[model samples]
Target: MNRYERTRVLVGGDPGVAQAIAAEIEEICEVEVLDAPREELVMVKVRESARNSLFYLGEALMCSCRVRIADAMGFGYVLGSKRNAAYNLALIDAAFSSGEEFERMPKWEERIEKEAKRQRDKRAKNRALIERTRVDFSTMDGDA
Candidate 1:
């Protein structure tokens, strides 16, 4: 993925990963918050598996904020009611989008990739655990 994509993935990813990025960036760069974190309701949509149709799952509460670093503007939107986390995301986004050179940024890319992998692994493990306990009753129809 490109730099901006990577940055977004890191910023929009798991809270721990986002926090790490925000914490590290704060030590090296200056950030100015353009918008305070605020919550809003947004419609959540889903595709019906049985039919090619879309439906609204319901309104999701989301947090959003904007930040500025140098001349670049960055924005962040996330699911749930985390004000501090939303602001952190905005700051991290702005720092990366600033286009200014930072020596530690390359290292950050590696960290982001690692964090993503970790989350994927965790999710896979959880899925496997859930599937294992899901009994397939159809397989026992003949016995009954």
Candidate 2:
């Protein structure tokens, strides 16, 4: 998966995926925390539909961290104050960016792909359930 999809899965999927990857990475590589997990506020930007102009939606609290694995540097930023998740993401990022090859890389990627599939299935099921309850108001008489 690409970086965006990978991060989305890690952040939105089961938290255990990142933890497992981080654990494996720690066993082989020395993790150096360049920046500890810290909570901060970031301006949320959005586009104005009428004028097609950019504006700040608001400020959101985000947790971020930086780490180094061998010579490669990795950064993790996620919404909310999830310190552990942020740190675990940093480790996972470092593992992917580092030059060192991992024997378990294939397995890790498989797990992530599976999680992505599961999430997609869940959303589809939910949409189907909601669709079943949808009301066709146009077909109803005004008296009713």
Candidate 3:
């Protein structure tokens, strides 16, 4: 993934990642908040598989914030209720948007990939456990 992709995943996925990035940026440049963080119910969209028509899936809880540094405006929208983490994500976005160099992402790439694998493994394990409990009700009495 490129810088923006890496930033998106790191910021959106883990609050710790955002905080880590923010701390690194804070050491060098001043981060200014343009808009305070707030939580709201945001509409999520889904598409029809056949016709590709879009519709609202439902409202998802979101925390978002906007920040600025120099002349660049940065925005962060993340799932869940971590208001502070959202602000940190926005701050990291602002730092990158302002054309500052950050060297943390290389380290983050490894960490993020590891975390992703770990999550995938955990999910697969859970799925297998759930699958083992599955039984076909129609076949329980040998009814075809």
Best by TM-score: 2
Give the alpha carbon lDDT tens digit for every residue of 1-144 in model 3: 555675556754655766876777678677788779999899999998999899999899988899887887878777888788878777767776676555664664576576556666888999999999998887676654
**By TM-score, how accurate is candidate 3?**
0.67
How high is the lDDT of residue 83 in model 1?
Answer: 86
Reference-based lDDT, each prediction? 0.80, 0.92, 0.74
- The candidate 2 region of ten consecutive residues with least summed lDDT is 92-101
Give the Å error, residue 29, model 3. 1.4
The true-versus-predicted C-alpha distance at residue 50 of model 2, in Å, is: 2.0
Q: For model 2, state the Cα shift of residue 106 in Å.
A: 0.9
Backbone clash pairs for candidate 2 read: none
Once fitted onto the true fold, the runs of candidate 1 whose alpha carbons sit more than 4 angstroms away are 2-14, 48-51, 130-144
RMSD of each: 3.2, 1.8, 3.9
lDDT of model number 1: 0.80
Worst 10 residues of 1 by lDDT: 3-12
Evaluated at residue 99, the lDDT of candidate 1 is 88
lDDT of 1 at 97: 81
Tens digits of per-residue lDDT for model 2, 1-144: 877889999999999988998888889889999999999999999999999999999999999999999899988999999999999999988888886778998888998999999999999999999999999989999985
Ranking by lDDT: 2, 1, 3
TM-score for all models, in order of appearance: 0.74, 0.91, 0.67
